[model samples]
Target chain A: MSYRTIDRGAAATPEPVARKIRGLSDRAIAWIFVAPTIFLLLAINIFPLIWTIRLSFTNYKANRINREPEWIGLRNYERILTDSDIWLNMQATAHFLIWTIFFQVLIGFALAWLINKKFKGNDLWTTIIVLPMMLSPAVVGNFWKFLYQPQIGLFNYIIAFFTGKEPSSFEMLGQVNLAPWSIVIVDTWMWTPFVMLICLAGLRSIPDYIYEAAEVDRASKLRQFFTITVPMVLPFLMLAVLFRGIENFKMFDLVVQLTGGGPGSTTELTSINLKREAFEKWRTGYASAYAIILFVTVFGLASIYVKALNKVKER
Target chain B: MAYSKLATASAIAIAATGVAHSAQAEDLTLCWAAWDPANALVELSKEFEAQSGHTMNFEFVPWPNFADRMLNELNSGGQLCDLLIGDSQWIGGGAENGHYVKLNDFFDNEGISMDDFAPATVYAYSTWPKGTPNYYALPAMGDANGWFYRKDWFAREDIQAAYKEATGEDLREPQSQKELLQIAQFFQGREIDGKTVYGAAIFTERGSEGITMGVTSALYPWGFKYENEPGSYDMEGAVNSPEAVEALEFYKTFYETATPPGYTNSYMGESLDAFKSGQVAMAMNWFAFFPGLYADPATGGDKIDFFVNPPQNIAASTLGGQGISVVSYSDKQDAALEYIKWFAQPDVQAKWWALGGYSAHNSVLQDPGFVDSQPFAGDFLEAMDGVQDFWQEPAYAELLLAMQKRVHDFVVADQGTAQEALDKLIEDWNEVFEDEGKL
Candidate 1:
């Protein structure tokens, strides 16, 4: 059959199907189309969140499901807030998040700016630099652990060669002073590429004519960079920061594989502490309270950050 | 027509086999830590499978994750394991939580006496009230924290002369905790056969129970106690005793000045790796691993020697072992009980020891040639005689994590003084007991 004939046949639906839907309004049909999704959202996301909020007020242990949980009137929240060890975990988390975002943005922007210049093998260099981002964080954490090994690791050997110190004199993952930095280094190595790609997009998005226009006004190269290049890329840079900020706030797998929050709790992030409470210690109710607190902190901060990002975009 | 005839014939054959064995066969799964003994148990269960006409399966988790995995399984009432050989620390939780079948009635009916097992194993691995006759499991593997060393290095003449010159004493097996530290310090960063070797590999692992187990080896020898008196929960002076501080400081010294670089999170596997790879002069691990270590081609035979954790104020070894129990949730309880029955036989336990699984049976342990059976056998007996265990309370996970943090803070991370760390540990334990309503 001709294409037009088939089209006509499809367009004019059979009489019974058309009559079945004849009385329905567009909104009702739309609801029909979206109801399953709404049901799923309620079942999986909303219900669990509400349950967690309820559990946060109780003294429930997940492993002891047979025992009835007693209502403790926010005692879990009270204790978690007062716990000194928890404060230490928060400080460790803040240190990790701030340092990782700082290094990633700094190095990521530099690499993106360098690569933005049309040079030989530029695409190949971009691909090579982005290789670390492609790897699983767990895998990155695992291999970096070996690399940070003090005795026979390549990292120690490199430092020794330059500084003329013994290779085994310093331990990156074993020392309280160095362990936090060790995690920062691995995170920068693994995730800087992600930030770079975002920054690269920002760098590429700036029209070349703007640079040409600045040059027409006899602007210096440095002047063009400060006035045009930086201002134009600020929004994307902020977006990358927001993403890394929220992600690093809840960071677990990479740091866990690398440090398992040791050398004291020097590298124990808030998320690691949460997991220990919830799963290892089976303090489900307390961990629920802990999770809610972390959620509020991140959500409140990110909401403010997104508003700033939008304002930057408008500018 | 021919197909129908063949189907009928097959049905007749099935019925004939079903009639021959009235109790229909079932597949039974037994879960335990994945180690040398699990492999031995798998080999040993082949005989049980043949006799019982039941297919045997296993679920073996690594030691680091065994408690977390198996406890979750039992807590959730998962049918994964019909029988479980769980850690000694888990007995209270298992029994009190109703995850394990109460085996007292089964034992009574089957005529299996708990008296046939070593008293220490029976007390440590099977009881919830601890040292009581209330049984929840059969003591399967008896283990304790023990030490091994490079005998070949100790036998070196130049080393002996160097040791004599350094300390004005003979270099031999460590007689006490102080001497052990002295020898370990001597080996640290010393060149041996063109390779720079560390002093020793002890457990400094932060996650789970590594540091607690390792530090307790030192603590127990110094006469450390969890409470001022037994069952009192009064830990102000005892848990933070001067002896505990000294022991903690000694372990910290070992970690800081002696052990291999990047040995912060080392545990049983790492200890084994250090010994087998010839990286350390000495190492600490469980007696359960000794058979495999002895049979190892690379670092076994004349090259190795074993010692119980050396005494300081008193003789004590950290108990390490587990008992076998039928999970209450299992539908195949009869089959699992049959396996347990077969396992308790004297002959089977003797074969179990022969195959590298530590048999706690008196028949095997009291045998005249038991010491001569293996080089480390005498030390194993000595260690078991003095074995002490950490809290086997249902709140053990909480109790253990608290110690892991406090000890790791002092010893590995250098965060606080040993006295301060122990004080914090007592506070943490106090909070846990209060929550459990036992204080």
Candidate 2:
């Protein structure tokens, strides 16, 4: 049919379908709405990462404000890999992350389970338990250092009272043997409550009907818990693990306040080492490489953890 | 003709506005640490502004992160600061990176004399490579590391009698390493003023540069060398020689037996706390802190006295201080240089020292009344006279970190034997030098 004949089919021009079947233009308008968000994401996140990657291959001292920078091509990465101090800091960080996660999760989950039971003043107890995680890490680190004092501290007093011996003890921040564990204790004391809160939320979500069904089946309380409660709380526990893992991997502020990565490099975590290299040592190119390595490592671990979390959710 | 006249008048008005703007922009900014010294400098700088007719901008950073903050601002080539009072440790890196203007020609052109300032202070902090190029920085604060003790405790007849009975000699302030050890031993765990007090406490903090300051005073007098016979930067045996090892062992013994039980974590603040609390009979610290020590009524009431760090093989302490520098990136260089010159005058420097500051001017420090003005003035002057600095190489930061690591391991951690600590320190120092092509 001719184009004119299609238009002449009805009286008054059949009102020319004012609402066109607009498809591509509507999608184009939708993209226009999201363009700012895409630009923002690329500007804030992607740009810095690309810049850091570029700096990693150069010999740019971030502190050297005026010197013309030259490209060195992976020399900084080579140097970081070979540097014993960098490796030592990585080891310290690994030790801290693994141990702190273990203790925080174990203790937090236990506390959550205990508090989940119906008891008098359970709400008050839970509030009191989670209060430490609310305090600033700097405040916790400073006060804990004072509490860890060998002679004059209350911790020593407690030990002396129970053992009835003279209160001479190891220096917490000074001696290397005790310093790393000192950090561990402080970190656990602060963050274990966070894990506990997550576990509690998970525990509270368990329906009573599931327990009732298990009871009808004449199952033991332990058997019911193993079958119903644990599987239900598994996703929450993984979430708690993911958070604490990411947090402890970048631990800097508390260590800075408590020991300042000291009694001499004994507790210098990777972040602290990176900061020293970047700021104090003025080795910006090298520190950028160090940061990239840490970032990649954390990113890889988090991706794996997210996959595990997906599996838990599916189950 | 009427239109031409109007255009000329308008052009003349705009040119006048530009001239006025130029005059108003003649202002300078000064940055320094936030403390008594900075307050005194601010007071003195106002006089310069009054006389020179230039505005002043002062930025006083807290002592902890002052270096990092200033370096960031300087490197960005921003005019956030024009002049700075910087720690001596920052001179090498700051100068080499062109963050500061070389002041030799400026000093010459203005008839400004560096001789009026303390030679040691200028030699330690102002020159790059320890007196090579006049690259950047000027002498501002002339603080030096020194030892302080309770003169009353040292003068006690009972302590003297007890020490004489035990060692078969009269107890006097030690002048050599062996004697210093003996003196420290004599007062270990002594009951004084009806309270049990320790003999001495020198800071051994693993953080920052506290331990390095303590170890340097002991190392300087043991015939140690910071440079080789050919006059290159050599800190090998100097840091961990047999004599240095012996000195460290003695220090460890003093720490274990003579120091307060909680001294390993001691920093400047803790040392002050211990001294103020009367728990320590002796301490080694910065001379600038003498004002703070004397200002406190608890310890300032004629209870605390001081002496220079006792001589070992040579009488020296770490050349500790800061330098005033003009930012090369700043447009207000002329104004800043004028303010610095005004600050260096003897009369102004005397006021600076009198109003709770350490004078960097030689004339001001040497004035007869300087000793009588402040309680620790005599000791301060004596300590400043005996100042020696660390290697002022461009790689000084790396060198300091390397030294701190080894010294901390030996003294605080006891992770390795003294010999092993020294051997590793040598290797590390050589590694740094090799990387810089200094070896």
TM-scores, in order shown? 0.96, 0.89
* Regions more than 4 Å wrong, model 1: A1-17, B1-23
Q: Which regions of candidate 2 fall more than 4 Å away from where they truly are? A: A1-27, A65-74, B1-28, B49-57, B133-135, B229-231, B234-240, B368-375, B434-439
- Evaluated on the second chain alone, the candidates' TM-scores are 0.95, 0.87
Compared with the true structure, what per-residue lDDT tens digits does model 2 show for residues B397-420? Answer: 667777777778778777777778
Query: Residue-wise lDDT of candidate 2 within A234-300, one digit each (tens)?
Result: 8999899899999898899999998888876889999888887777767777778988998999999
> Under CAPRI classification, how is model 2 graded?
acceptable
The collision pairs in model 2 are: A65-B75, B221-B313, B319-B388
Model 1, A123-164: lDDT tens per residue?
Answer: 999999999989998999999888988987899999999999
Candidate 1 residue-wise lDDT, B1-439, digit = tens: 9999999999999999877655658889999999999999999999998887889999999988887888888878899999999999998888888889989989999999999999999999998788788999999999999999999999999999998999888999999999998999999989999999989999998888999999999999999999887888899999999999999999999898889889989899999999899999999999999998888898899899999999999999999999999999999998899889999999999999999999999999999999999999999999999999999988789899999999999999988799999999998999988877788
DockQ of 1: 0.71
Best by lDDT: 1
Best by DockQ: 1
